[model samples]
Target: MHTPLSDQLRILLGPVDLADIDPGATPGAVSHEQTEDELPKLAARLDDLQRRLFAAAQGGHSTRRVLLVLQGMDTSGKGGTVRHVVGQLNPNGIRLTAFKAPTEQEREHDFLWRIRRALPEPGEIGIFDRSHYEDVLIARVRKLVPPMVVGRRYQLINRFEQQLTAEGTVLVKCFLHISRDEQMRRLLARLDDPTKRWKYNPGDVDERALWPEYQEAYRRALEKCSTDEAPWYVVPADHKWYRNYAITRLLIEALERIDPQYPPGDYDVEVERERVLASG
Candidate 1:
């Protein structure tokens, strides 16, 4: 059974020492024994709560926007979380943006221009599959860019996120930390299964060889980017199902705090009741 949200989250958001997490350890599958084998039930509860929060947000005339940034190595369930966790949200109020390799126009602009363009409007949730931190994480890992440039980018990202938070956008960054061995298992499974083969990339193996480098990059990324306004949550992702639960729970808590509500009725209470009775 899964841990109740209250219990599970008490552990999930506690202090994490990056040095103690072994990137090479093997993570097992998620268990539902405690949750009555009802992953769907838990997920549904989260969805319903989110909708209520959205309605409350609209009602309260709240301008808060939520930006959920997800980062992880390949096969860490970033795509799956997007498909499952946020899939049931009201499409009108949520925006899902995947930051891919820069296009010609995007590359011509500053690194943050595309991201700025994708920011969520008032009372909306914006999810970035991979976000501005990519410049720091991937670039530092591969040494694809100059050292000076990477250093500058990290500072820029921190300032960028700070600005967003200061402007009423609640930023939540999550790093999906998966074990090296489990990653290899998932990668191989993708290759062996024809239906799942599409997820495999030849570059995944190449990147697997640099697991240590990636870990170092992640350590630094979290160290530099986690802040009072825009904190980073490093989730243990060996178990995809647990990862999903953690994500849904995180979002639920955040939305509940925002406490979105429907707009008040414009009509007088007595008149409104009379109108309802007349219509009936």
Candidate 2:
């Protein structure tokens, strides 16, 4: 029997050292071509599930929703994952937010306020490009917040997530794990290819210098926040295709378990069919 991809890729509650995992290794599957072949079928399944979820909401049958939190380094394919993976589902069924550095107005509110505002509506899929976790990941690594404050934020995050879960949000948290060497290579590729050159940022190189600090920060966040209600999965992301495939599989599994069925119409199907036929 085949193991579920989530079990193979999920970060079990424990200490997480990014250096220990191979970013290029494909988890639970064999080849890139094999994954490529499987993507369309997976995408079709997602399309049907998303539509059913939306239909259930429109019929006032369910309040359940999904929030996909994507956390990764600069070149870890977070945006690419959105474009290639979550992009498979219907746009109407998805609420996407690419959280950049907070603005002055955003800085005035609690960190989670902006996060809450961007949450998915009932039965929709919310995709966070970089999420509230940055409060711990980047904030801790750069000393943007006091150590005590950072410590407190972890507990607060746990509570905030639990609150979300209690309110019918199913969280799918993902950490796109990539090696330092792979990051450097991708950043350089951005500079080399004219099409990709627009994405090149000198600041990313500076951040790369603090790789060890970032790694430690990520480890700390993963350990502190991988709660049972909403645990994080570490996607080995040097292989972009596998990252997309694995995440797609994870989502399908979650939605299938939810098993949202299309709600029945209020009026008889025969009546609607006769009315349509008569109108034509």
Candidate 3:
């Protein structure tokens, strides 16, 4: 039997608790294996839920906006998650932004200036491929900024997210939790496949050298910013199919919670064959 939306959502919204998982584990290394036959059913269920969300969003006015932030180490499937999980959303109401290293002009401004510019307008959904959390993740991992400044950014981010939620944005942050082994598997695949060679970067190896520091950075980011208004859901990314299913399920629930409604209208009885009843 297919799982109910409420139960699926509960599992999706439950604590990520990465501390309990091994740092060096692969995506599916520790979890129970799923049978290949189960994938089609799971995919179909996600597609059905996504269709409902789109219908609700088309009619409902209460859903102001949704901002989904995706953060993870290279090969953790941030781009892939975006591709599969939200692939079917109504494009007219969605925006995707990918953040990279700062330009000279961007470097001159405050860290958040660019981020603020990318926020979606009311009634839209914004997906960030990488985000301001870069301020904490990259800066902390490489010591690029002062320790004091970096440490303070955590609370600043929490307050910033809370303010966004207060103002009508629904924020969902996801950290793709992939084990080192799974990362290496993906990294090697990138190198080995000619079609995927474009994704391989020498800098990835450099980052792998500082894996421990990145792990600490992620730990602190989750601990500090997972708040009531904008919480983080760390999806286990070893099994790409499961990761996509989990994220899509969570998003459908959030959209449903908004309960979009159609504008009121009356049927035109004069144009219909059936007789219209007179109002009292």
Candidate 4:
């Protein structure tokens, strides 16, 4: 059964048309001010949840971890989301990997090899800036791989995620949905501001030309790979504040469901306390 939270975020577990989602839409009439006001509270809750999850793992009571896979086109605020939403948590418990173009060494192995190595440990939360989905997304759009190979990768990804979930890793895949117009605006903004110019890539304009193809590739990937254990959520990211709020809410709700609790001490608590008291 879908939780109310899942339904609220339009979590994608099946077929979905990218065109159907308005990138500017927010849940209900939520305002940017409201979202900003609530963000700290949600972030606090997320921090507590993360601590409990880590504590459980330290005590050898939790094998479950969280993997947050963030995917979006250029200028969709992937960096901003990481900064505002995920930045609140304890850095020690967070494992962040920003996937770049595969190295020659990485290319030699199957797509999942590097990704598998980066998976969060039992107590940690792993954040993938761009993940194995690139094998299907950019590879499909750029024809980096044969169609038959890309087709096979979808199945491989699903099986890989299934294995992760079976072994106790929770997955939250988010597509930071932004419209073409908004993307162009952001790209142009990057060019206009000297400080942001470093973020501007001439290659982004080249990719922008292939926007439709990328969208289709993303659509297919999201539809085919969203499983019960690892569903994808389309986050309307045109409004940065709302995007942070929504993603933070989704994460808090997910952790609540997991309900990680600090494990009891293995040794006798009273004896340990008495020993400490005597030493003092």
Candidate 5:
């Protein structure tokens, strides 16, 4: 069941303005300190759910999988979410992909071709740090594709996601919403911290300059692609602890809803037990 807090952060299939969400706001009664304190328990629950799902798949009793798509501006904490929120899961059951600019061969095919290839198998959880939304997001913001083409890709994305759901994949798409000032602070911190300096990309500054355009691009993509099969949730991300807590709760709700169960053994349990005992 979704908690009231998860319900609060979800973006319904309709219009939404990035301005309406307060990046610094923590939902309900939860504070940053409270979220941090609660995180380990929530993460443990997530791990158990993932183990169940993976076990069911291993037993050939489950065909369902989860795909979590995270989209946000530079330094909006997608990496942090992956590390803190999802890092607890068994790596064998998780497929994490961080997308960058398409390679020459990827560009030669439809945008979703590469994305389709990376989807999780049955009972696995797939996480995309950035996803197919880039076809409409960066592609539109930077004029990498024509406006009409970008518009068409939106419909294609919707249809593709519909197909995914129909084929037994559950999709959770989150946009890590952070303020421009917050983004700047994070970027500056990256530059100042020697250990984090490797994460600093020169292109991030150029992309930051076009913040307004990217915001508009995201707004349009959210409106067009948010659907029954795969809804987009805009998570307040300026407070990293709150962000991780909110997402962890959301995923727990989703997994509980899925309710994956272990399969009964095909052979006779009594007979198997007797044979094993005799052998020992």
Candidate 6:
């Protein structure tokens, strides 16, 4: 029996050590050409499931929803995954939000307030390019909040996620694990290509200097917040194809598990057909 990729990539029980796994590699023996070939099949399946989810919600048959939480270091291909993977799903059912530095108004509220506003409604698939975890990750790394405050947000996040799942949201949390060496190469390439230079940030190099700190932040976040309701999956991301493939598989699995059933038509099909014919 083929083991689901979720079991392989998910951090079920761990003190997350990012160094233990190779970011350049994948959990499966699948090849790049194979992944490319398999994506269309995955997309087609995902499309059918997503449409079922949307259709179910339209008839009030289900309140099912999906939320894909993506977190990673700079140049870890979060955006790339969205373009390559999420773009394959129906745009009408997607609600995407890329969280950035908190605005002054946003800072006035609790960390999760903005997150709650961006959550997917019934039958929609929500994508968070970065998320509430920032309250613990960067907030701890940069000392944006007090150490004690950072300590508390972990439990807060866990409770929040638990409540979401209780209300029928399937949460797929992914940490795009990339290596330092690969990140340096990509940074250099960004500077080398004029079209990409716009994405190059001098601050990125400064952030790179604090790599160890950031990794520790990630470890703490994963350790404290990864729960049965919302487990974290470490996606090997040095290989762009594998990262995309892994995430696509993760989404497919989550939706399949939901197994949304399209509701029966409220009106008789034959009557509808006759009414349509007479109207014509």
Best by lDDT: 6
Number of the predicted model whose TM-score against the real structure is largest? 6
Task: List RMSD in Å for every model shown.
Answer: 3.9, 1.5, 5.5, 1.9, 1.5, 1.1
Q: Predict model 3's lDDT versus the native.
A: 0.74
How far does residue 278 in candidate 3 sit from its true spot (Å)? 24
TM-score of each: 0.83, 0.95, 0.79, 0.96, 0.96, 0.97
lDDT at 60, model 4: 64
User: Model 3 Cα displacement at 173 (Å)?
Assistant: 0.7
The stretch of ten residues in a row with the least summed lDDT in candidate 3 is: 4-13
Task: Please report how far candidate 1 places residue 37 from its true position, in Å.
Answer: 5.3
Report RMSD for candidate 4: 1.9
Clashes of each: 13, 0, 4, 0, 0, 0
Look at candidate 6 and tell me the lDDT of residue 125: 98
Worst 10 residues of 2 by lDDT: 1-10
Question: Which window of 10 residues has the lowest lDDT sum in candidate 1?
Answer: 2-11
**Candidate 1 global TM-score:** 0.83
Candidate 4 minimal-lDDT segment of 10 residues? 1-10
Candidate 3 lDDT over residue span 155-215, tens digit each: 8898889889987787878777888888999999999999999999999999998888898
State candidate 5's TM-score: 0.96
Candidate 5 lDDT over residue span 102-127, tens digit each: 99999999999999999999989999
Collision pairs in model 6: none
How big is the positional error of residue 272 in model 3, measured in Å on the Cα after superposition?
A: 14
- Tens-digit lDDT string for candidate 4 (1-280): 2244556665556577999889999874357886677667777889999999999999966898889899999999889989988888899999999999999999999999999999999989999999999999999999999999999999999999999999888888989999999999999899999999999999999999999999999999989998888888888899887788778877877787788998988999999999999996
Query: What's the lDDT for candidate 6?
Result: 0.92
- Which of candidates 2 and 6 is the stronger one according to TM-score? 6
Give the Cα lDDT of each candidate. Answer: 0.75, 0.89, 0.74, 0.88, 0.87, 0.92
